[model samples]
Target: MDFVLQIINGLHVGSIYALIALGYTMVYGIVKLINFAHGDVIMIGSYVVLLSLTELHVPFWIAIIVAVVFCALLGMLIERFAYKPLRNASRITPLITAIGVSLLLQNIAMKVFSANPKPFPNVISGEPFQFGGVQVGQVTIYTILISVVLMVLLELFVLKTKMGKAMRAVSEDAGAATLMGININTTIAITFAIGSGLAAVGGALYSTAYPIVDPYIGSMLGLKAFIAAVLGGIGKIQGAMLGAFIIGITECLTKGYVSSQLSEAVVFAILILVLLVKPAGILGQNIREKV
Candidate 1:
């Protein structure tokens, strides 16, 4: 029963990780650029929700929508102001710029929201439900259900919409996509928007679980989500979810059975082993270098 409980806990955490990982994977898929500022974006989302709830006295559902929309718009702004301008520059230049943006945003958030952690209102009842000898929380079920729904909607959008087709075209070959009349700039911005929106949901859900918000919170979770993305396959959406569950389960089991201090190390070691065995990752396709 304890083992089952641990697995349930892992799934709950994994669902949040997967939501954040989706953001990383989507951006990487379209642009081949890891937006380091994404972490700060999640941080911003948390603050947005907190402000909405506490300051504006908004309902939880409305606050969630507002937070996600705000993050999506912020993502669009970042792509327009920061990334788009540096498109023609060296790869390292953009990467460094991303890192700079990340630090800048975090510091700004610290100044605006303060360095201290603030508690979030309990959106979901914390009562646990028992199923097959496993105790699960309503919040956990909500997170998983929402994650699955969003993933499905994303898949449908990508596979069915004209804008999504243009995105795919640009992702496949930007130069060709531009020549074929696909709006590369628009597609890139939209990709960032979707990715950031997903990250907002993740931030909100995570805050519900921990009920605290701080500037540096995103740093650790962002790194872990990125690891999960890479572990499953950086460019694969489904792989990100799978990797998240694997990592979460491993960490939970380790902490429950082994030493808490060594849980992260053990999980990362396993990540390294998986990468060494299959560098492309479990669900990744073979990426050929451009000549």
Candidate 2:
């Protein structure tokens, strides 16, 4: 029963990781740039939610919506200003810029929200659901359900929509996509928008679970989610989800059976082993890129 409970907890945490990992994977798939700053965007979104609820005195749902929209637009702006200008520059250039943006955001957040951790409002208030010997909290159930639904919706949107096809084309070959009448810029921006919006939702769920808001909260979570992405295959959506679950489960089981302090170490060890054993990841392909 304890093991089962841990699994449930793992699912909840993994769901949030999956959301953030999807953002990482999608943007990487489209732009071929690992936006290291992606996690900081979650920090920004969490602040947006915190301010919306406390300062604006809005409802929880409204706060989440505002965060999502704000993060989505922020994603676009970052892409346009920080990334777009260096589109043709050396790859290392944009990578450095992403790091700079990340640091800038973190410093701004610290200055504004202060380095102190703020107590997050638990908008979810309900008893745990009993399932025989096991139990699940309302937040856990909501997190898993919302994560699954959003992932499904995202998959459908990518596979079925016209813009989705354009994204796929752009991911395949930007110049070819442009010649085929697809606006590469728009497709990439849309990809960032979708990914960042999902990250915002993940941030909201994560803060609710931990019930604390700190300038650095998103840092470790984002790093873990990034590891999940690399473990599952960096550019594959399905792989990101699978890797996130594996990571989440491993972390929880390690914390339960082993030491909580070693859980993160175990997760990183898994990443190292995966990289050594299969650089392409479990679901990843090793196709060479076209120059």
Candidate 3:
């Protein structure tokens, strides 16, 4: 029963990771840029929710909506003004820009929200559910359910929608997509919007579970999610989800049975092993390039 409970806890955490990883995977698939600043978007989302709930006095759901919209617009703007200008530049240029953007966001957040960590509001209050001698928090249940639902919806959207087809086309060949009247810029912008919106949702769920928000929180969270994306196969959505669950479970079990301080090290070590064994990731396919 204890083991089962730990697995559940891990799943809850993994769900949030999966949400953030989706954003990373989607952006990388289309733009082939790591978007290191992606994690800061999660931090921005948390602040949006925090201010909305505390200052604006809005309902929890409304706060989430506001966060999603704000982050979506922010993502689009980042792509439009920052990334788009450097789209055709050398790859390393955009990579450095991404890191700079991340630092900029962190500093901006520090100035706006201060360096102190604020307590996240307990929007959902309830006792833990006991099942077969295992306890599960209400927040955990909500986090897992909502994350899974959103992922499924996103998968359906990407597989079945016209815009999704355009996204895939752009990913495959931007020049060809433009020649086909696909509006490459708009497609990439929409992709950023969706990915950012998912990050906002993930941010809200993360705050609920952790009950704290800080300016630097997104950096570590984003790093883990990026690792999850790489582990699951960067361009594959389902692979990202699978990798998140694996990472979440491993982290939880390690913390529970091993040293808490060693859990992160263990996770990174596993990533290294995986990379050494299969650089393309679990579900990633390696394509040979002609020299």
Candidate 4:
């Protein structure tokens, strides 16, 4: 029963990672850029929610919506100003710029919100559900349900919608997509918007689970989610989800049974093992380049 509870806790944390990983995978799939600043966007989202709930005195759901919209616009702006100009540049150039953008966000957030950690208000209130001698927090249940629903909606959008089809086309071949009349810039902006909006949701859920918000929270969370993306095969949407669960569960179990300090080491070690054994990732397919 104790072990089962740990698994539930893992799912709670894993869902947040999956949400963030989806953004990473989607952007990488279309742009082939890591967008290291993606994590800082999560931090921005959390702050949005924080200020909205505390200062604006809005309802929890409304705060989430505002955060999502703010982050989405912020994402589009970042893509427009920071990434668009360097779209055709060497890959390393954009990579470095992404890191710079991340640092810039961190510093800006520090200046604006200060370096202190703020307690997150409880948005969801409910008693833990006990089943078969195991108790699960309402927040955990809500997180899992919300994550699953969003993923399903995303899958439907990507597979069925016209813009999604355009996105698919762009991801396959931007040149061909442009020739076919697909507005490459708009599609990319939309992608950033969706990814960043998802990051906002992720930020809200993460703060709900951890109950603390800080300027630097996104850095480590984003790194772990990136690891999850890589573990599940970057650029593969479903793969990112799968990788997040595996990572979440592994970290939880390690922390539960092994040394808490060693959990991070174990997660990284798994990444190394996966890269050595299956560089393409569990659900990733290796595409051979034609010389």
Residue range 126-242, candidate 1, lDDT tens digits? 678778767788888888888888889988898899998998888788999999999898899999999999989889988988899999889989988888999999988889988
Provide the lowest-lDDT 10-residue window in model 4: 128-137
Residue 30, candidate 1: alpha-carbon lDDT: 84
Q: lDDT per residue, candidate 4, 91-155, as tens digits?
A: 99999999999999999999999999999998888899888778888999999999999999999
- What are the TM-scores, per candidate, against the unseen true structure? 0.96, 0.97, 0.97, 0.98
Worst 10 residues of 2 by lDDT: 281-290
lDDT of 1 at 136: 86
lDDT of 3 by residue, 157-248 (tens): 99899999999999888889999999888899999999999999999999988889999989999999999999999988998999899999
Error of 4 at 92 (Å): 0.4
Tens digits of lDDT, candidate 2, 11-69: 98999999999999999999888898899999888889988988998998899999999
Pairs with backbone N, CA or C atoms under 3 Å apart (clashes), candidate 1: none
Candidate 2 C-alpha RMSD relative to the actual structure? 1.2
For model 2, which pairs clash?
none
Which parts of model 1 are misplaced by more than 4 Å? none
Worst 10 residues of 3 by lDDT: 128-137
- Candidates, ranked, TM-score: 4, 3, 2, 1
Q: Against the correct fold, how does model 1 do in TM-score?
A: 0.96
List residue ranges in candidate 4 displaced over 4 A: none
| Residue pairs whose backbone atoms clash in candidate 4 | none
